[model samples]
Target: MRVFRILAVAFAAITSLSAAPASAQFFLKPADLSGPRVTGNEPGILGQTLTGATQTELDAALVWNLRAALNVAALQCRFAPSLFTREYYNSMLEDHAEELAKAYKTLGGYFERTSENKKQGVTAFDQYGTRLYSGFSTVGGQLSFCQVASDIGKEVLFSPRGSIDRIAHERMYELRRSLLAWGDQAYRGYFALAIPRLPNFNDDCWDESEYRAKRCGDFFASNDSKSG
Candidate 1:
């Protein structure tokens, strides 16, 4: 009977352990910065043109912005070996190649239509790409940006084909918000160190080689003695 009871207890302990969730490095979920929903037509959200862009062109801009953010995260977030930023990004390139290519082509067309000539358009398009990647660069918020990008990248893998624009329109603001620096929010209690007091180092308290006991009172004097 005792043996059976012990076995039951052991099984219960094992079951409890197995049921508990595994812990990883914890970070608070960032505030919802993706403001009121829109129809993927807001060019201003991703730093694109404030005018002249049609709905399709705006959607393309959002998609390109998201791609740039993730690309930057993949390059900057490699310090955290566990993050799948690079792998997920590479997979995204393959899985959504058609949609991404379409967005890039649409953006190129917009620049060409707005520029004075083909050469100027090409130059403007190249500058836009450069600025897009540069916009996501971060030093202080690198961890937050990388973690957020990884989460978004994983979601993109499961997203429906040709719906990358929808993901961008929904999460691009949140991604931008993550670029602002934030730190641990939990309040850890203050700890005051009790540093040991040292004896006086005055010349009178020390002989050439050793402490002068007569001048220093005690080598390790009491606080009260020193005060007196």
Candidate 2:
């Protein structure tokens, strides 16, 4: 009988362990993300395009887009320092400076080639930089944006130099998608905000602005009881 009881307890422990919940995570996994792979020509992803941009120019745009996204994360997502997006961005600047510089130069050249004059080219390049940063700014989707950017930033840190563009190409689409708000996947529809129902303050429930407890009856009584 003692042996049977011990075996039953062990079986229950194993069953409980097997049924344990999945680990909690704040951010969506990469496989869970939505959006198409960035081909660099998408106006939605790049913000604006230089007319007649070649493949090299397009790749440069993608690299700059990724940089701007991470920069935004560094500035805006600092609230969660543990994510270290700012650190990642700073390190990326040092580690991939050559590739990033080349991308910037390439993009500047594209603008210069497309614009009418040097002055206009400079203006166009400046505007592109401004728009690039602004495009990633978000209030409603801050949580999701920061989370996705944090993941991408860590990945960027691990990525080999000169391969930043490849990471940009692979993740930029998902980064853009993160700008839209996404709720907790596990409890998405299970939760609803509870608003306390206020007591009616109509004339029927009051007499000459004095609350008539008798008129209100059990409503206040129940609430008072709950409070007590």
Candidate 3:
């Protein structure tokens, strides 16, 4: 009976090994840990769904919002170290606010300028604005971690060589990770909106710095002969 059980187990193991594909060997390969690619659609938004819209429409919406969300998140993460010092935090907050405001203004300009572009219109801007709001809400969510850190930091003031300091450090890292994750999700949704349609459009047509400038230029040039 013991010999029969051993044979059965060996047969099952052999069958499982034979059924496994060569591709399975590389299934757990490590990803490249380098920073995200700047030119293509950001990774986070690659396969997201926009609740009420068709895939194409959502893709267009993602182009504008995803980039903005990434920029905001990057800036916030860069500013986070300053939060440890009151004076530095105040300075960083001023700088952070200015940078964010500039990004918001730039986004607003894109929306106003591209309101009539055939590929993406005012609706894209509205969708992008909604994404910005969502990203900001996530920023607010990190405050809970900050509060915990603050509490621990205060407790450790009396006994500076205790476990409370370690706990505070762990909480800070957790807060930072949470902020980054939220930003990535927001950007992912934005990329989903843009990447599918980017190939069909010319670089001139979708210039981020000068919204719809190429389309407007092409339209005028095409109409010049008619006016003449």
Candidate 4:
């Protein structure tokens, strides 16, 4: 109960900023800022995306995603100090929204053709359309900050931006790792059977699903079930 409350408070603080293109895009909150979200976790809740995917397909998808983070976008480009400027970061996303959308569409088409998303129809990962579309947006943001951090010639702990950048990097890196780990668990809460069980951590409840459902509502619901 206490942990759940803390997480709620933490999440509120993290989300003080309103919705935008990158709320859950690149950086995680302070809790996730430190490490991977799925370290030593089990496959508990399968959402709409993983509904049709086999473990193998999900694993491949995981690999594709992680590699995309590492090999594409900012990882591929030189992390020049100049790229760290906030203006560059914000402007590029704004200017290239159309181009990026087109590219993502092409990639989505390619993903649909993959063994995982295309078992029978383009429905396996259909639920994750939004996530898949925007997941990579944050990498560029993180990379921009990382480039700045690199130029500062000190550890991220040295300055506020560096610290934030460092947190963003850790969060992004761990998010990739978590996506990979999630494939192995194969559990879907509320939407599907709850066999494997998710991580027994405070944060997992919030991340797995927040919407209402009959089967797993109490289970997924935070201890503060008293709240509205």
Candidate 5:
């Protein structure tokens, strides 16, 4: 539970930052999330039908440790035949999901969000009882907390397995794509607002800034000549 403890601390941090900027922030629905080109991960799709799974089956799904926790909390709605319907210790999330999302809303930012994007990372422990990792990161923004719990709600709608639902895994892939797209959009707005003083990319928006005197001098020069 040491790793879980880190998540609890993060929720507290999120609560204190409730005044997080709302002007440039955005919302994500499943529809606006279909276009990202994920190069390195497996597809985890949903809405599939499983004919033979039984309520007593004990096999874990794919990698739904968080969802497992939510199952324990009963915060998530369970399908009649899910492996997660009964409360289990292993499937429980470290914190309450809704509170985590509420706390996250006030704390999201370019600096904070970008810090969590990774193709992948591992969550494991050593035998010495030392805490190796305080958090977890996926391709999306940092999901080390209950922000991902919201997805768990939707993910529970189509359970093919108990702890490791295949469709849920596919939805995770979509979530990574959607979060990336959202991050890109948020950064675009951030740069748009920052253009007055930072007319150049300055290593921040090296690939983003549409107009930059430092990196795109030739492009700007051509525009100036055209105006002349």
Candidate 6:
């Protein structure tokens, strides 16, 4: 009887361990900033009138592209600084140069497309549709800054532009200079805090899925349950 009980306990433990969900892993993945790797021989100009895209559209597009590029630069800083470096941190500097180049290309493409569409009297929604898109980019930038600051105990220099593209460009320039002066550790620290943490699955009294499914309610209730 003693032997059977011991065997049953061992089996139960093994089964419980096997049923456990995998622990969450965190790491910053690099982003692609290379000029839209997909382009073709589209006509250089649309009808003689020029494209129908407006100045507002062009500005919005620029902001969209710049933010995208900045995000890519941040990822590059995380995963592949060696790819950016020429020697020591020079390669990282080069990576920033390449990121800026891509940003410019994307901006130019936006302008060209806008002009072409405007000439043909066709609306370019891609540009105009990006009016409020800067919010996400701003959040990403803030998270990136926080991650770097938390990790390296250094400040991330950012621009004060309301427009996404200009902010991205200015931020990149500032980040590049800061990186050169402070080294990669600071940026790595930023990533550590910027990335979200997973819930503790081992706590049986609290159901992670229930909390995730619930919408906004009493803040104190949510905090108490989460704490428990």
- Strongest candidate by lDDT: 2
**Can you give the TM-score per candidate against the true fold?**
0.67, 0.70, 0.26, 0.27, 0.27, 0.22
Evaluate model 5: give its lDDT.
0.31
State the lDDT of candidate 3 residue by residue for 1-228, as single tens digits: 334533543464456556653321211322222232222133334222333344334334333332333334334433333222232233223323544344445544555564667346457756756655464335433533333222323332222222322332233233233332122233443432221112324566666755474454554444454344
TM-score of 3: 0.26
| Per-residue lDDT of candidate 5, residues 79-188 (tens digit) | 22122222222222322334233222322221133334422111111210021011122223322112333345434433223323343334444444432213334345
Tens digit per residue, CA lDDT, model 6, 1-228: 334533543464356456653211112342211222111111211111124545444334443433443444444344322222112122223324544455445545555565556533223434433432332233334434323322221111121213233443333333322221122333554433333334434344256555432333344455555454
Please say which candidate is ahead in TM-score: 3 or 6: 3
Q: Rate the local accuracy (lDDT) of all candidates.
A: 0.72, 0.77, 0.37, 0.36, 0.31, 0.34
Regions of model 1 farther than 4 Å from truth: 1-34, 38-44, 188-228
Q: Cα RMSD (Å) per model?
A: 18.6, 17.1, 22.2, 16.7, 16.4, 22.2
lDDT of 5 at 49: 17
Instruction: Sort every candidate by lDDT, greatest first.
Output: 2, 1, 3, 4, 6, 5
**What lDDT is reached at residue 64 by model 6?**
40
User: What is candidate 5's CA lDDT for residue 91?
Assistant: 23
What TM-score does structure 2 among the candidates reach? 0.70
Candidate with more favorable, higher lDDT: 2 or 3? 2
Candidate 5: regions farther than 4 A off: 1-31, 34-61, 65-149, 157-164, 177-228
- Candidate 4: tens digits of C-alpha lDDT, residues 92-207: 34433454444445435545765454643355345454455345444423533333222222222133321322333334444433332121112333232122333344553455
Local error of candidate 5 at residue 73 (angstroms): 14
Q: Which ten residues in a row have the lowest lDDT in candidate 2?
A: 22-31
